[model samples]
Target: MVAITDKEFKQLTEYIKVNYGIHLKEEKLMLLTGRLQKVLQQEGFNNFTDYYHHILNDQTGQAVVTLVDKITTNHTFFMREADHFYFFRDRVLPFLANTVQDKDLRIWCAASSTGEEPYTLAMVIDEFFGKDKVFWDTKLLATDISSQVLDIAKKGIYSNEKIAPLPKHWKTNYFKKHDNENSVLIDKIRNEVIYRKFNLMDTTLPFKKKFYTIFCRNVMIYFDYKTKIELVNRLYHHMEYGGYLFIGHSESLTKEFTKFKYIMPAIYRKE
Candidate 1:
């Protein structure tokens, strides 16, 4: 096993945070080592330092993307936070319907890895307004830094085993069979969603229109204090005046001076 020396660990994590705004902790050493060994061998680097130096200059972003994919935790599920969805349906959606006169609604599934979270959001929206109402104007913009995952998300395919837990009617409503095997979202729903590659660390949000609600859940736990505050503030700036932010159940905004205030547990609305 190729172990990361303490110095190598420091250098690599520093590079990641500076370039990508990700903070690796002491406990991630084992995980990093496990993920990087294959990468190091592929790069023909004998030790950690050589791999670090080589990748630091890898501006094409391929190497860095792989590094990010390995280190970041992307564990999530459809309707994982059941309460948030119910709350949105009962509270936020009506408020949105009343206030936002425009039929066009923009939703950013900011950390939309492997497609589950954004697809789940699309399902909820489709359920509420039906396909005829939401099929055109309300776009679900799903983004992540990993091109690998974006491809999967864009394809909109999932194993039968993976999507098994979804309600049977929902599975029938949103998805179609793939090669008589796995499940994939129908073209109507799939087309409504736009999947793109985005690096959250970037200071500028690329979209021309501000988002109405941003689900950046579970992505920020990797960030240290400095990066977390900076990213949160930037997200706040990109949101609409009354926009809502949903972080992980484990994430908090009380530590920051952001104008966002708590709405329900783990849900915050912009002031």
Candidate 2:
């Protein structure tokens, strides 16, 4: 393995936290080294400092992309959080469908790791709207910082294990066999989600229209309290009044740092 010195680890962690909002602690030194050792070996870089310099000096941005991909974990599956989807379908969708007169539903899966969450949302929307779905604009925006995961999300294929948590009807309605061991989401469901490579740390969020619901789940645990609060505030401004935000169940937001009304354990409203 390529050994990273204390100085090198600090340099890399600071760069990541400043640019990507991911706070790496000293304990993650081994993990960081393990994940990047092969990349360093292949690139002919003997030390983390040289690799860091290469990343900084690379104008194409691919180095940074690869670094982020290596350091981040993108493990997700269909209907990973069942209750949130239930609430979205039963409570959130009904409210939006009734209140929004324009018939345009804007939804964003902000940390869409490998496409399961957004696709699940699309399926829920389709099932809820049923035949009337043709009349509304329900296309979803799914974003992730890692291009590698975004590419996997775009393909919309999953193994049987990944697809297991979904409802049976969903299996029949939304997916088709990819081979003996996997299935791919039908284009109808796949097309409903638009994937983009987005870093939540960007100072300015680029969106012309505010979203009704944003699912930024499970990724914020990497950020420190300050970064988390700042991102929460940014998301608040990008959402419509009375919009809902669903974060990871393991995460929480206190009233002291954010204005979002706590609706439940992991859900908030921009009321």
Candidate 3:
């Protein structure tokens, strides 16, 4: 493997931070090299510096997309953090059921990697609304930075083992088992989620309507303090008043940084 030089590391890390809001620290050099070395080799580059220049000079932006996809971790599973789903179903959905006057529920799953989180969310919403779902616009907008993952999500297919954590009823109702034992999300449930490629580092959000709930989850762990704070504030502007924000349990916001009121560990409400 071609070892990344100090200058190459700095350039790559800075580029990632600026474009993606991901903070790659000095200790992550090995991790970066491990993830990117194969990319460099596949692209016929001999070193990280050459690879960086190629990425900079690539006109289609596909190089950077490939870089981000390879460097960032997309490790997520159905019901990975189960408590947030409980809160969404038991508490947040009830409140929204009463409060959202238009019967249009806008939910954003900001970092939906490979469909697990948003698909799980769709199941919860389906169960919550039951037969009344047709009256409400409960479709979820699930976005992620990587087009690779978004493509996988759009397919709505997964191995049965990957979805084993889902409730039995949900498994039976929302999915169809393939002959190979892989489960494909039923069309009704799959169509309810709109997947898009979104870069969180964009200075302004493009949504015309505010969301009632946003599930950003574990992705923010890669961001630094300033990026996280700024991103949270941006999300605040894009949410409806009293809307809920469900982050990863390991992530937190200090009182000084955000206007969101803490509802529980990893859960906040817009005031």
Candidate 4:
């Protein structure tokens, strides 16, 4: 495998950081080479420099999408962070239920990778409202930068092992076994989540309605401090007053830089 030269590494990493807010450190050079080398070879690129130029000069932007799909890590699973779901069901949903006069609950899963997180949210909401769900609008908006993942998310199918961690009730209610024994999310549940391709680094959020809750969990670890702060502020502006934001359990927002009130570990509220 050809190694990424220092200059090539800088070019690629800087491009990623500036365009995607993903901070690829020097240590990730080997990883990048491993992920991207095959694409370079298949595309008949002689070296990293050529690949870099192709990425920079490609007019269609499809090249960048392919690059992002290959390089960005999208490792997530059902109930990966269980606490946030619990808090959303027990606290956030109830508050929205009582306060939102229109009976519409706007939820955004900003980094919904392979459908688990948003599907789980939909399940919880379904269970929460039960017979009363007909009166409320609980459709969720799930977005990710990679169309590859979004395609998988839209299909609403998972390996048995992938769905194993999901609650038994959820599994029974929301999924059905395909002939191959893989679990496919039932249309009723699958249709509740509307998936879209979204790049977080876009300067402005174009949504007409502010969300009551945003689940952007585990994605910010790839971003540098400034990017994260700016992203957080943008999120705040796009959320309704008293809306909730859920981040990764391992992530935190510096109180000094953010307008959100720290509600608990991995959770914040707009006040």
- For candidate 2, the 10 contiguous residues with the lowest summed lDDT are 73-82
Model 1 scores a TM of: 0.93
Inter-residue clash pairs, candidate 2: none
Which lDDT tens digits does candidate 4 get at residues 203-240?
Answer: 89979999999999999999999999999999999999
Which RMSD values do the candidates have, in order? Answer: 1.8, 0.7, 0.9, 0.9
| Candidate with best lDDT | 2
Tell me the deviation in Å of residue 192 in model 2.
0.1
Provide the global lDDT of candidate 3 against the true structure. 0.93
Go through the candidates in order and give each one's C-alpha lDDT: 0.82, 0.93, 0.93, 0.93
| Per-residue C-alpha lDDT of model 1 across residues 65-149, encoded as one tens digit per residue | 8887777666766777777777777777677776786666788988998888888777777787764563337678998887778
**47-132: candidate 2 lDDT, tens digit per residue:** 99999999999999999999999999988877787899999999999999999888889999999998888999999999999999
Q: Model 3: how far is 129 from its true place, Å? A: 0.7
How accurate locally is residue 72 in candidate 3, as Cα lDDT from 0 to 100?
A: 75
**What does candidate 2 score on TM?**
0.99
Give the residue spans of candidate 4 off by over 4 A.
none
TM-score of the candidate numbered 3? 0.98
Best by TM-score: 2
RMSD of 1: 1.8
